[model samples]
Target: MRRIKTRVFVIWSLIVVAAFSLVGCGSEKQTPPAAQQAQQVELNISAAVSLKDALAEIQKNYQAKNPNVKILYNLGASGALQQQIEQGAPADIFISAAPKQMNELEAKNLINKATRKNLVENKLVIVVPQDTKLNITKYEDLSQDAVQKIALGETATVPAGQYAQQVLQKLGLWDKLKERVVFAKDVRTVLAYTETGNVEAGIVYKTDAISSNKVKVAAVAPEGSHQPIVYPVAITSGTKQQKAAEAFTEYLFSAESKAIFEKYGFTMGK
Candidate 1:
């Protein structure tokens, strides 16, 4: 009877060991809960629409190196994005096409001041449809009666629009041309309007103009016509993913990111 009991105990021990081994194998095949959570992290980035192409390239390169991190972009007018953030939008990072939007956020204590940095620069330009025969050769030509239905961003919110407004005001054309303006929500919208010949002309960033085959830059807004076109990047004060946001922000200033921006016609920030 004792011998029988000993054999039964050995058999039970073997069964228990097999069960544990199977569990160990299962664990090895599955990611740990902690690791799974880490891999699911999504960073929400709000950026100006003009940055779409360059930022998309940067996002691709960044994701290649950081397979675990997902970047979700909300591209639009800087002013619209600023208002969204102010209304408690779930944005981890903010990149503005102009300092005015960033400055407002900074003043409201909505952005983490320590993480703020100027990312790039752009030039405003007059663009027209590739097939256009308009005699608009310079910024001043927009004042002519022959040019009607010009597209510009809403000066109150869009940085590109605001810059264009500044230029028009500087050139003493704002009052005369405001009546002929078709306001766009963002620079990209203006580009589309110009590209499709929906408008006689549009004001947009040089970077934006170069990205499109349908639009030709008719003239570049002279320097000092407006406040400098600068892109400012910052981590939002409300972000829970501060470390990840910081990593992405720093990456924007890296040589790789700069190269991509330059390739897209953006000038690196000083």
Candidate 2:
């Protein structure tokens, strides 16, 4: 009878232990309501390639302050980003290198127009490989024989290329150099071409040219040679995280962000 009592006690103890273990497992699998509510949010930002360095630094700082927020960047030419957003890409914020791309989105009601603001400006520059001995010191020198291939972004989709086209056209070099122009997908590509010595010269944003150690600025396009180079930021109309996106957009204009941009050779937008 004592043995029988001992066996029953052991079974009850095992059942209690199993019950406690099940409760612990259930608790471990569930997140607190407050924690679930404060879940991490990812904001998708599509920005011009020229804004890459500045934006990346800004993102790091912003995330440090807002620990629950994560920023994902899709950097490319402004026009290409615009097209992606138009095609229903999951972009929370859009920062374009040119007003033209932003304007197109605004016209289509794809972005919150009220949220649109000019963020920065950049200058078009001619860059050459650091070790280049090419005599192309100025934009006009591209017409010289030694400078066979000049790299510029594809004008149709690249804002830098469009600006380069305007400068070249204004200087009466567009038609003459068009045949030798090595069109790139983006300004970074143009920078790469120049950096690798694949092209005698390339046109890119002053910020991009300065970012690379392998390239050096040969000339800057005179002001007014092209349309004003403005970087504009806005929240997309389709963004579900409007509040977070707006916060990010405002953070971009903050002193900290502006200083970072300036450090990268970008000027404050007018």
User: Which regions of candidate 2 deviate over 4 angstroms?
Assistant: 1-29
Candidate 1 residues 1-270, lDDT tens each? 999999999999999999999999999778677757766669999999999999999999999999888999999999999999999999999999999889999999999999899999999999999888888889899987779899999988899999999999999999998999999999999998888889999999999999999989899998788988999999999999988898889999999998999999999987
lDDT of each: 0.93, 0.92
Worst lDDT run of 10 residues, candidate 1, spans: 31-40
Worst 10 residues of 2 by lDDT: 31-40
Candidate 2 whole-model C-alpha lDDT, 0 to 1 = 0.92
- lDDT for model 1 comes to 0.93
Please give the lDDT score at residue 200 for candidate 1. Answer: 91
**TM-scores for candidates 1 onward, in order:** 0.94, 0.89
Model 1 residue runs over 4 Å out of place are 1-9, 27-36
Task: Give the per-residue lDDT digits (tens) of candidate 2, residues 154-265.
Answer: 9999999999999999999999999999999988999999989999999999999889999899988987899989998899999999889888888898899889999999
Best by lDDT: 1
